[model samples]
Target chain A: MKLSHKELEIQSGQFGEVRKLALEHQMQVGKFFDAQSFVEISQVHIMADTEALGLAGIEYLENLAQYPDPQKQVWVPTITDPRGSDFKSFKKIKQNKRFVDLEKRAIDAFKQLNVMMTDTCINYQVFMPPVKGEHLAFGDTGSSIYANSVLGARTNFEGGPSALAASLTGRTPMYGLHIEQNRIPNKFFNFNVRPTNFSDWGALGGIIGKQMNSYWDIPIIYGIDYKPTSDELKHFGAAMASFGSTPMFHIAGVTPEDHLAQNKNPKMNNISLSDLNNFYKSYLPKDDNLDVVVFAAPQLSLNEMRILSELLDGKKIHPKVSLLVCTPSAVKVLCDKNGISKKIENSGGIILEGVCFYNMHAREIGEANGWKRLMSNSAKIINILGGYGYETILNSMEKCVISACQGKIVK
Target chain B: MKENVYFGHIGIGEPVKGEALVADDNFSARYDLDRINGNFSRKSHKLFNQSYVNKILVLNVAKGGVATAWMFRSMKISKICPKALLLNFANPIIAQGAAHANLPLIDRFESDITKIIKSGDIIKLFPKEGKVEILNEKSTN
Candidate 1:
């Protein structure tokens, strides 16, 4: 699984330990496959959550600290916090000293890695989209699949291997996503109506996920004319994958390769459409009513922040309900830099750092706050909330803003 | 009373002393064992917070051994530490009659059927469980 001499020494000056970790982690992964492991990986896309890993999170930076081997891996550090997570919550982690010392050890490590640190995974708009026949190694599960299906990039939910391979030996299992001939469409979708609202996207996504379970298919979704926001897309992507284990999808006009581009429109094997009655029967749980509205799972994008700020300008949050927003520190810092944070803060929404409603285990945060009827401007938050309570509802950022201002669902 | 079967390595045999349990593969044991419905990690899970118990746990398949074996050993060490004899997630099940395999505190490891099948049909060619069990292999593969 070793590369040519030139590739082996490609990351020499970057950060030695960072280099070692990358080689170790990725090569170890390479050993799993019988053949073509090192040749499989091409490009790297990072979807980071440093706060979650605490000290160990630095291990990621350590790996990133190196330049990638050519003739092998090209890495993209997708989104990261502007600076990095504050060392406060991370100080509590007991298992990692290497990571705790990251500030001193790895600031140089990040300098070596060539990937961009865009702080937002909710939107995959910043970088070059993976081409029709390319195979990529991406970490964000939703994005990985989205890139694979919509953008026509090839990748598995193969994060650890992809990340490691890019860092160390710079390779992957070529058997899965690397092959060009294997990149054809799988599932065919016939939409009943164009999804015009954020919830509409989620509604359609929910149906698609259920339709394609544990399989990869090309779903050509028709009729999605309204402008789709990042949060809406993230929600739809997560829900479709969570329930159905579906890895990829295609929205006729939105994705890189249209379903029509692939060898003629195959039969609509998987149907993803929404109308008033069926959307309710399929998406809205009988028990869902809406208690509180939560924003930020991957955290809200900058545009979302501005929209929310203007919406909540003069109104008070529902006296009985609560509105909470969690943004990665990087975005918060940017907002702080631009004064967007203060706008959101004055508008009555708290833009906290580190912890999010999804990964956090304490339901008390959701329950103790007395947000029995949960509403979300975010689809990611809505998906996680769906795990614990049945009353959660998914809505667009605009609808949520109005609800927050009016203190009710329809205000 | 419907005796709920927890097919995980969390609490395998010690429960056998007086507790009830069953041995199954890891993937199904984890995924098929729904949390919201309280299948494996039901109300009794209240005794602990995590979904699965500890000690003798099942592997993803007695083979295709990746995160299953070591993770269960980890679970047994702390996360899902159970009260009884440890059960292993093995194929041609780890002869339940074996004694040391049921040691109250020792974590028994087993692999899933899929792995064994995928790795090879010639069973005799496989590596020893203890040897494969020690690997902290990276995920790049």
Candidate 2:
């Protein structure tokens, strides 16, 4: 791979050991992909939640922080994905002190590296939005999928280690979604059913993701008569990336990358409303008693928060059921100022900032709280939590709120 | 005794020998694993309940989240990781993970590796050399 003079110098340890190490890591990755050169990235969003990082990952960060020179700090603007738990709400959520200690250590190490702890996967919405054709190193799969398809930014599924490396070096290997040739549509899909709500849109994405289930296959979907809001596509892209591991996609007239599609013909498999109904019905709970109802996985946008707030107005959550709402801290601030947070909290729902449900030790918490039957409005969350021993049910945002109130599946 | 050798793209980490755990299904540390017990925990996965530790995992491709990259590092730390990975194709997340964990990962073989190798086959991976030798014939003799 080609390296600039400064990169070569860093490789030879003229720069600090941290930069040298970061460059070495990037070089090895570049070789793996046969990347010819590095692409300068504007910003980096790292997904290093404590659950994924573990002790070794934290130790690795701490070791890097031991570097004396501040030159070892991140070269470009860098932020983080959602944390494992919100420290302010950890006790309320029954998170043990051990987890909190580890979280603190990880945060301290990141602070030393001069990384902004945005703690959001929806940084495209609240933080700096990636511009068209903008190169970035974003770690979260949902974030990358959205940035590539919706925002027309260039990135791959960078992961935590790679994103951190890119942050330190201010660049990443020019492979995967970074190059234009790889972005063309490999599969075509025409939607036979128009989605009515966020869950329906998510189910549609999940269906298509399963059909074209690979990272390399970019599916260009056609025949959407209506426009989807950012929040709807947020759930759609998140579920698609979660279920399929898909990185980039195009939606005829919808997404930014749609124009680059070589094939304009929508002569692929068609997805109908019945297929979506079956997809949702496949997760229908056998019993109505709910252990928990969640509104997260991507964390709620401000619009989603407002919708949830209005849904819970004057409704008391059943004592047997717990309603959890996860949102970005910045969005949560807006929710607080606008009284959305108070309404949800007053109705017995816990609104957490900077932490999603699945990544926040879902298995341990489920076992600790005896949460066996979980209901969520998120197609992405239900797809993930099933492996963690939760009998997941998929519902619309309104149904999920109603289920929380009734302490059972409403339908 | 006959030796069957298959070449793949040059990969990371040192060459090593281990029994093959073959599956046509795709892999993801975050989506399809119970790392604590070293087993494929996702029920829908073909290798569900199978141990991945100390084995050379042969899968078709990689799927799902970027957490796999960091998960590999922690799994290595806990000594519950596959010795190496062989895939027909790999996304950047798997490549980055293998690099971080320093695990041998060779992909982009001429044919579907999952079909060529079978479970319990003794295999020697030459990552730097981009070669995978099926040593079962030699071992039986």
TM-score of chain B of 2: 0.94
Whose TM-score is greatest here?
2
Considering just chain B, what TM-score does every model have?
0.27, 0.94
Question: Highest DockQ, which number?
Answer: 2
TM-score of each: 0.62, 0.97
lDDT (Cα, 0-100) at A84 in candidate 1: 30
Q: What's the lDDT for residue A229 in model 2? A: 93
User: Model 1, range A257-285, lDDT digits (tens) per residue?
Assistant: 56344647366643444343364443344
Off by over 4 Å in 1: A1-35, A39-43, A47-118, A126-135, A160-165, A223-235, A259-291, A327-342, A353-356, A360-364, A367-373, A388-391, A406-411, B1-51, B54-78, B81-141
lDDT of 1 at B19: 24
lDDT of 2 by residue, A63-122 (tens): 988887465689999999999878889877788778789889999999999999999999
Q: Docking quality tier of candidate 1?
A: incorrect
* Candidate 1: tens digits of C-alpha lDDT, residues B1-141: 112111223222222222222343322222232332333431222222333342222222221101121122222333343333222333111111111123232222343322222211111111211211211212324
Q: Give me the candidate number with maximum lDDT.
A: 2
